[model samples]
Target chain A: MALISPSGRLRRTPFSDGVEAAGVKAYTVYNRMLLPTVFESVEADYHHLKKAVQIWDVSCERQVELRGPDATQLMQLLTPRPLAKMQVGQCYYVPIVDEAGGMLNDPVAVKLADDRWWISIADSDLLLWVKGVAYGRDLDVTIDEPDVSPLGVQGPLADDLMARVFGETVRDVRFFRFGRFDFQGRSLVVARSGYSKQGGFEIYLEGSDLGMPLWTALMEAGRDLDVRAGCPNLIERIEGGLLSYGNDMTRANTPFECGLDLLCKVGPEANCIGHSALQACAEEGPVQQIRAMEIAGDAVPGCDRLWPLFDDGRQVGHVSSAVWSPDYQTNVAVAMVRKDHWEPGTRLQVQTPVGKRGAVVREGFWA
Target chain B: MALISPSGRLRRTPFSDGVEAAGVKAYTVYNRMLLPTVFESVEADYHHLKKAVQIWDVSCERQVELRGPDATQLMQLLTPRPLAKMQVGQCYYVPIVDEAGGMLNDPVAVKLADDRWWISIADSDLLLWVKGVAYGRDLDVTIDEPDVSPLGVQGPLADDLMARVFGETVRDVRFFRFGRFDFQGRSLVVARSGYSKQGGFEIYLEGSDLGMPLWTALMEAGRDLDVRAGCPNLIERIEGGLLSYGNDMTRANTPFECGLDLLCKVGPEANCIGHSALQACAEEGPVQQIRAMEIAGDAVPGCDRLWPLFDDGRQVGHVSSAVWSPDYQTNVAVAMVRKDHWEPGTRLQVQTPVGKRGAVVREGFWA
Candidate 1:
């Protein structure tokens, strides 16, 4: 691994000072911002994240703000998911697709009001797409990236730590729901959602000026809770089957193929840009689908590139993410396998960087 | 500096193998791709780049291919620059703008044909914007990122080294003009241009399979010319006044503010998306404009964030990029200054991370 060169292009987040002070070891650039990949170590971070509370500077999950009378219409046009039932202060895991029913981005659409919304995006530049569509159609809406950064508190003790800062009322926040809370006289949107399966809260910090102050406040309050600077651990996320957008799926795959069919409300009634194409895909099942697999091996090398999956000399699928799980005592992986070869207990061969390894399709993720 | 975690999301270039084999020391993610930032020390690489020829794996300069009947129309809608006089083989340094006449990206538009073009982009995701426009307006065109990786040969001995590999015709290629050259039975777009004041030719290698082969071929052919693996040197670029997209200008800036007013032909008949808005900006000159500044300092730290510029406690502007030039024996910087403070030789105080430093606006860059 090479050192990441510091530049203005690869942006620094608001929580960079605290992340550095905590001695972040490795980083990955997400949405053109610094995302900490390791603190003590990958395995150490994973263990700590599962056991105690951790603060994640997920400011890289940039928000694309849409504000106007046609905001709801524009939001509906971008995804196949039904937004009519969504109330204010709710976040929907929307699978944004292009006209070909291909995945452009998988973002969380946070509904602020009928005329305002924030699409917290993954890796791709979905802002350009939204702006282009709105401009081309001459829609009565505005699209741009606002100065909103999300600071996450994850793990089993997340609730206790968050309640200490935002009050015990935070405990009542339902899943995928958010509430306006006051911190240091500034109102913030605190949501009961995060990237991990572990219980957590994501505070949508509105201004850059309050970034460090809030970070320090959390650290000071959670001193007895064993709080540490952490990031989304690869081992834990893969085990939880949390799919990474560019890594696990790209524009070539539809939502159905990525096991995101539940999020795609495709039908004649749906007016998404990829509605008709997704309807066609829904009729005929996906050719390849994302599946959890366990590879028979020791610790594998970094899964920097795709590992081809084969069954008896025929390529059937590819493993997108793989990591050694200490708790599960197995090498867990997420693969996109062909329909013919994707079944529980089906044996396959994964071509890892070191050598070939035996792999078996699991019924589900470890966690 | 933190180590960059390797992952498929941070895409590896076709020449990644060659770069790794050459002992790449550091990288900066550009357009979600691994861009080698240092092979040796920054100063060592800078000194070497000024003398001998070097092969640069600038594959991060991704191409957004626009094909079909409405390609020209779609292209015209993205930039304020006049494209009427552009020839088939010509490359134009066009500054792309949004509806409000703000600079989106400054890319080199390659005219392959009337209906076929490639906008070799800078740091941002310009593809989404182009696709959105085409889709919204129902234009008969396609937009996609093609597998065209550019391998640059730069420095004083560039022409000598390139001639040995691609024949003498490469020497005849005029500045900002390209010619179809054959390499290993594959036709490539070889243009006499690069991201440097040093002379060079950028070969638009169309296929990824030929990346390593061509890389080795250049290294083998230029053995006597002291060819090395190199990247866009920070010092050299800043000294040459080569503006970086995200660094020197962003969506908040207009082309006129970046001293690119000559490129903006915002007349009534321009027929561009931002023509009218830019005409208004042209009428009322920019409030703040980019300028070259010389800072009085021993050595400036890595400028990862914007440093605010002050004039006797009143905020005047901000410096975006600053570096201590070993050759020039001064701290060279690129700053955006307000109209009242942008005049040459105007003194200002730059708030660097270390402390306050006196700075003066230069008439031009060092080189």
Candidate 2:
């Protein structure tokens, strides 16, 4: 919730507990600036999540509402893909870019109604970006962050569990589609979208206090469903070839180089944000392209910054993100490499702070 | 990092981005006031974690260091347990308490060197508790959150990965024991303790810049070791019978009731914090006891507060936490039930928000 200050600048609404960035404690110690929270280790998480199911509080996914006559135009300007053919109840994975063709955010835009669109965004502040784009564009739209707490009910059994808890109506909602329903007298917009490639749902709530209540209600209802308290682990996310805005790619990356060229369409009569730059990139082709690789050994590839990749003692590219896949029992990584070496099965060496590691091109998705 | 204000008050060290809470983006969503980070969803983390090893950044786990001559005295005051029998390199999972025997913070106290104790605490600021207790008591000790980030390398292959990355020297370090060694010109304190029951290592770094370098080095050296990006998920942790402080126990809960009496001692020679309340509770026996339950449904049991248990329409106890264990394909839960109903195989009706949920008493270790 953003508070409109006396000066009219939007500021974060501080919580009564002074912004509990983590969470409330079961007990307070010393003066109470600390509490007890448990962290799950990686391996145990992998086994449980893949073989089973898990629940997570991913309320942080920002939903930018675009409703008005020019809502479609605003969306078309913000994203590289066209929203003209998108219909109500359908969701599209759209990439929001800047004029320089730089990536802004990768969001799942759902057409809730004829004119109302809910864009579930990644790390970037989509609301602010939309407001910025709305200015001077003459796009008639009402932008606001709904009081929605998107609870991620993820895992292989996500769909089944949702069917059980939210009623079988949930079973009818197709992929990339959303449905508004009543649970405990409160309205909810349940969408078939999530961070994990595993089948799941992101339930959007109207209030924060609703989190605990809904959390409890789901648990009680899911008692027979075998739902459990779980948070997203890093292993499966990276292994599935998923990209995090700040970790895998950032504002500095372009959609073309980030494996999003299919989204960029520069047609005449479309005055989208960064249209010229995207058109130029499309014509010239992306200098660096995103690719996946399999590194030899048990290395844990990290994304502090781009790490150099070498081929025949020559600089080729850098690894963007990497992780050891417990399933494949090998190291899989995503990197932006030179176009020539981007072919799958190409061999390369990556440099780390410790030493050089060998890598080979592999298909991106494990599933 | 704490910075001293001109007036002498302590302020958190600011980051270069002018963001006081640096890296907070990894946890909370700035836009969705109530949501978690966006990366949480797309990542079905724990799966890969199960098959391989994972390194996690949970620097959030605070540490309360006790280093004064009277530090041992402070320990006695905080815990109802006697630590005279505890040896260095060994750690104890103990609960700190208030005068009323109410829970404080549950910490894992590791004796690094003689009189030099490193107590890795849950989310609580136990250092202040220690400081306050020491102020008027005849004790000497220093308490503070160190400038260190606790990195966990956990998984089934954690041992092999550690040996390969940190060298065979790590093999000598037994579970719960820690040792200091030089790696790549930098000295580090490596401990074999991890949240997952599976084997793993924890390296406490003095700074964040080392994050990338250390992560890269580990990946490079452990290329043969399956390592993945993973964060802890709540489902497996609860199913494994791990006790979460905020969820399972709180300041209102006593060590006697939370099943920590085994770690408490009431000897007259040991003047620990909250000694009298613990002694009283011990003598009277705990009013409630923490136990595991097998819910009679496929619905996942969740922490919906204390669901009152009723036997023959008579109030008995309450269930605190529950989950659907995909591994077991049943609902499992942990609760603080009345002593009378704590017996294994006892049948009871758990009054959930939805309705009366059936439950049966089970052993503590559900996993």
Candidate 3:
């Protein structure tokens, strides 16, 4: 790996000072911002996150705020998910797609009111798409990026640490829900949702000036809980079957191929830009689908590119993400396989960087 | 600087193998692809780029291809510049803006034909914006990214090296005009335009399979000319006043504010998306404009963030790009200055990360 050149173009988040002080070792550029990839080490950080707690500066999950009378209409046009039933203080995982039913971004839409919403995006610049749509159609909505950064608290002890800082009332927040909580006279939207299978809360810090203060307060409050600065661990996410945008999928794949059909409400109630195309896809079914696999090998190298899966000397699928799970003592992988080869216990050969390895399809992911 | 984590998400280009073989020292992510920032050293590469021919893997300058009946109409809608006079083989430097006259990207529009064009973009995902517009307006256009990658050959010896590879007719190619040239029996669009003051040509390689062969051919053909692998140098770009998008300008800036008023044709002949908004800005001149400046200091630190410029105790502007020029023996900078303080020879103080330094507005760039 080579060093990343320093420039204002690769933006720095507000929590960079604390992150640097905590000895972040490696980083990845997400949404043109520096996202920490390692702290102590990949394996050490994975073990620490599972046993204790960690504070993640996920400010790279930028928010695209939509406001005004036509905000709801514009939001519905961007995704196939049904947003009419969504109430205030709810967050829905919406798969944004283009006109041909291709995936654009998989974002979490936070409904603040009838006329205001925030789409917390993945790696791509979803803002340009939304703004272009609104302008081209002459929709009555104001769309822009807001000054909001999400700080994640994850682990088994996440609730305990969050309760101590935000109060015991935080424990009552339901999954995929948020509530306004006051800290230092600033009200913030605290949601009980994160990118990990572990229990956690994501506090949406609205002001840049409050980033360091809140980070320090959390550190001081969780001193006894063995808290540390951490990021989304590769080993844990792969084992849990968490899909990463721009890796597992891109504009070439439809939502149905990614096993996101449940979220695509293509009926009359949900009229979206890709509704007709997705409805046809939902009926015809996808040619390939996502599946969890277990590879029989010592340990695979870092999956920097796609690894081809072969069945009887014929390419049948490809593995997008793979890692050795120390807790499970097996090589866990996420693959997009052909429909015929996606059944459980189907044996195949995965061509890793080192060499070919035997792989078997698993029914479910290891938590 | 920390190491950049390798992943399939941060895309590698077709020329990556050659770039790695040349021992690229650092990289920057542009348009979600790896762009080499250094090979030997910044200063070393800067001097070499001025004297001898160097092959640059500028594949990160992705193309957003627009082809269909509505392609010309769609192109006219995206920028304020008049495309009416543009011939089929010409390339125009277009400053794209949103409805409110904010710069979305500054790319070169390559007119392939009457119904086909390629917007060779900067760092941002300009594809999404184009797709969104076409989809929302129901335009008959097929928008997609083609398998095109540009390899730049730059320096004082560029003509000699290119003539040796493609015959003496290559030396007669006019600036900003592209012609089809055969390389390994494959036709490529070779334009006499590049991102520096030195003379060069950018060959738009249409196929990825020919990337390595072409790269090797160039290297082998120019061995006696001190040919090396290089990239856009920081000091040379600053001295030449080549403003970088996302660093020197963003969506917050309009074309007028970037001193591009001459290109923003808002008369009756042109009807662009930002025409009305830009006309208003033209009637009432910009509050601030881009200017060249000279910092009074030995050398400045790597400009990783905005440096504030103060007049007495009031904030006047900010310097976005700055570097110490080895040839000019002074610190060259590009700054956005307030109208009241943009006059040449106006002295001010710039608050860099290292310390405060005296600065003066320059009449023009060094190159």
Candidate 4:
């Protein structure tokens, strides 16, 4: 069900007809809105992930296309960060919050051009939210899923591996930077970004049937690199401090609490959805902020719900996330505590499902 | 959307509704057949994980309830392992394979009692498969989502943490063992098995309502123990060699080739869906077997895709899953390679998206 794209890369079952995720099974190609896909065994195709780099069919990650005259104006309403200053070919990590200041979703905003943009989302129906916001506003913008799939070339040697497929010049592409490349006579925008902290590149192929061919081409070109099949696992993401939506923060969490305040901008001149509440949250600091902590013992705690932080059995705040960090050799956790108890040196006690343990507050990032 | 369970635990919205998966925000609950609840923020809820022993609301990992006249017969047909002599209370890790001997899914089968079993599954639609296997057979089993949810107490100090909630008797339970305790006048079965290699316990609350009461009671009782919210992540799972369906082996991987032959039964008397195919595979031996390899570098590779395992520019196989083992301070990976190349010390090359890298097959656990 895969074919070569206009760019000569393999793509998903192409959109000569309409396509939709009918259900868990295979996707409906023509007239059907779903496809019954074989998800697990596909690992055989991912054999080139480790020592070598191969492309990923992350097309399942829903893409919200923003185009039209008011596209820029509409985007400004979604993200707390100002998109006015952003130019085409630029991207930024933006946190979209709800009315109560809770995080709606975290998406990567890619400014393809002045009047066109793409918001690659983690999870959450932001398209509906955007549409609702656009109901009364005469923003000349249209949102839809374009017939394109995002491809990632990741690994230790990702840069060199990709340069061979595209060109030697791709080796100089810095982190967070992107460039357009002509491969097989087709235009493709390659960006130096990925889920892993490891450096790599992401190529958005704008055509169907690009999966197998590109996969074959990468295999042929990368036949020398020892690559392995791999997929995103919940275990690695949490250990690496990568936040998952349904698993991490929900609509109840404000960007300020998730340490996303840097992306929130509420200058008097800027207008956007949920800006007032975000501004209020900014003016009035959060009651509790997300802080990382280190457990003193070898006993790594899993998901035990937060108990009031205690010192001499006195209550303070509660913890939110915790895990055994292989990098740190001790248990680490992210907790929401009152500003006073949020200090890095503050000592606290967490009530576990099993028993009590000693803990110290610290920063969130492990790497 | 969170509500109090009858047992006083804070039941997640879906659990409270007595459903395995809550309805998607886009759909009405009454009309939806399978409600796959999209949680708002699991990451934040997981914040308390590292510092304190946290209880996980893993209710999403549903237990396929099988209790019928021919339950034992059907259960045996589902797994590759021999379950003829399996006693009640014992659990077996079964690899469900298809006609080609590729894995369908791997689920933990716990024999609760005579003719009664529970299969805790990964994300898969297997109820129909089991039902089809039972058509016209004298099996009286029910397939439906239960109101129950599985809660886990994981971390280094899990034992001590459990003792606080269930009293010191918690120390008597062995690994993979379970015991019943009376709390809030409701009897609950607590097991010492957990996903983390680190020690911990899991308690299966019979109904959704028990979530909050148990969670609150444990939190209140273990106030001295730092109980935090935590969830599973990717980093440790790969290091521990835990295979995830969508990540490692898929329906395309046979038990023998996946290094899971130990879990398969290949006797003439045995009867399973893919038993014959598996037996022939055992006899002829697999052309490719999954093996662990130690890459010679500090650079952590991602699941970028399969790279070529080469010797002198000739291709052999590629690595499938790899990462920088922070604990071992080495790059490690799991790969499916030709049996000949799997030999220890076989030098190979990986085709990364970036460039070529050298690797030598090594032996033993990286962690």
What does DockQ give for each predicted structure?
A: 0.86, 0.01, 0.79, 0.01
DockQ winner: 1
Candidate 3, residues A1-367: lDDT per residue as tens digits? 6899889999888899999999999999999999999999899999999999999999999999999999999998899988878999999999999999999999999999999999999999999999988888999999998899999999999999999999999999999999999999999999999888888999999999999999999999999999899998888998888889988898989999999999998866667988889989988999998899999978888888889999999999999889888999989999999999999999999999889999999998887
> Candidate 1's residue-wise lDDT over B134-253, tens digit each?
889999998899999999999999999999989998899999999998899999999999998998989999999999999999999999999999999999999999999999899999
**Runs of candidate 2 exceeding 4 Å displacement:** A1-39, A301-303, B1-367
lDDT of 3 by residue, B195-217 (tens): 98898999999999999999999
Worst ten in a row by lDDT for model 2 chain A: A1-10
TM-score of chain B of 3: 0.99
TM-score top scorer: 1
**TM-score comparison, 3 vs 4, better candidate:** 3
lDDT at residue A310 of model 4 (Cα atoms): 77
Would you estimate the TM-scores of all the predictions? 0.99, 0.48, 0.98, 0.48
Question: Can you give the lDDT of residue A79 in candidate 1?
Answer: 95
Candidate 1's error at B41, in angstroms?
1.1
Chain B of candidate 1 achieves a TM-score of: 0.99
Model 3 alpha-carbon miss at residue B140, Å: 0.7
Task: Name the weakest run of 10 consecutive residues (lDDT summed) in model 4 chain B.
Answer: B1-10
Ranked by lDDT from best down, the candidates are 1, 3, 2, 4
Model 4: per-residue lDDT, tens digit, B103-126? 766877778877788877654435
Once fitted onto the true fold, the runs of candidate 4 whose alpha carbons sit more than 4 angstroms away are A1-367, B1-54, B136-138, B219-224, B304-308, B312-315
